[model samples]
Target: MTAIVARPVSVKLDQETRGRIDRLATSRRRTTHWLMREAIQQYIEREEKLEAYRQNGIAAWEAYQASGLHVTQEEADAWLAKLEAGEDVEPPACHV
Candidate 1:
């Protein structure tokens, strides 16, 4: 097994927030440092997913503008409804 190396980070938290973290750590039977690290990891993962979504939206918008090819909302809704109903259906065609 490879050894994991972690660097120490310094953060100044207000008294109220520190107290809350301490209480939660005690309740969860975890160290405050572990709680903080887990919180930071979760935050990073959530933000990364959000960033990817934003980028995909921007790319789709640009593609739509360039090609003027998109399915109508009604068409999309029908396709989604069929999928939700466990029916196999082809996606709607994009229009000029």
Candidate 2:
């Protein structure tokens, strides 16, 4: 059998809120501390997902800048014209 160690913590809440938590814990056959811990864990997981998205955006922008090339209006028009004419246009200088 595995044994789990528990720690003591203190928090303050309004009487109504405390009553609600107590009711919920009783109905769910769980302790208020357990419910609070589960809620906090879920919140942390959500924050991690948001942070990953933010980091991916920053990395994509850096990659675009590092590619070190830009297409002007005329260049864009020429590329489009070539594509419309069914001509094979080589990739831009920045691309492999």
Candidate 3:
């Protein structure tokens, strides 16, 4: 495993938000710095997942435009029904 080297970054917050975080940190028995770090880390992770999903969607759209291959909504519904019924079936084949 690799070690993590941290650096300092400064952010300016208004007094109301700063006081809220301080009060919540005090209630949670954690330092304000730790709360900020955890919040930033979680926000980054969630946004990264959203970004990857967006990219995948763009790629799929491009591929569909190139090949014109797709399955109908009825076929998709049937596959979903099977899965909902606990059947381990393969997905429907795509067609032009």
Candidate 4:
């Protein structure tokens, strides 16, 4: 098995936040360090997902501008409504 390398860092929390973290860690029978590490890991994952979504939107916009292919609002709304109603519906065809 491969060994994991760890680095140590310091953070300063406000009094109220520190108190909350301490209380929560105690309740969960975990160390404050574990709680903080878990919180930072979750935060990084969420931010990375958001960044990927933003990049995908930018790419889609550029593609649409270049190809001039898209569906009308009405068609998109119809497709979305069908999806919301639990119907298996294909998306509207993109057109100029």
TM-score of 4: 0.88
Q: How high is the CA lDDT of each candidate model? A: 0.98, 0.84, 0.99, 0.98
lDDT of 1 by residue, 1-96 (tens): 999998898999999999999999999999999999999999999999999999999999999999999999999999999999999999999999
Better of 2 and 4 by TM-score: 4
Q: What is the lDDT of candidate 3?
A: 0.99
Top candidate, metric TM-score: 3
What are the runs in model 2 whose C-alpha is more than 4 Å off? 1-9, 68-96
- Per-residue lDDT for 6-37 in model 4, tens only? 98998988999999999999999999999999
Model 3 lDDT tens row, 1-96: 999988899999999999999999999999999999999999999999999999999999999999999999999999999999999999999999
Clashing residue pairs, backbone N/CA/C < 3 A, model 1: none
TM-score of each: 0.91, 0.54, 0.93, 0.88
- Models, CA RMSD each: 1.7, 7.8, 1.6, 1.5
Q: Model 2, 19-91: lDDT tens per residue?
A: 9988999999999988888877899999999999999999877887887556666777888889899999974
lDDT of 4: 0.98
Give the distance in Å from residue 49's predicted Cα in candidate 3 to where it truly belongs: 0.3
Candidate 4 wrong stretches, greater than 4 Å:
none
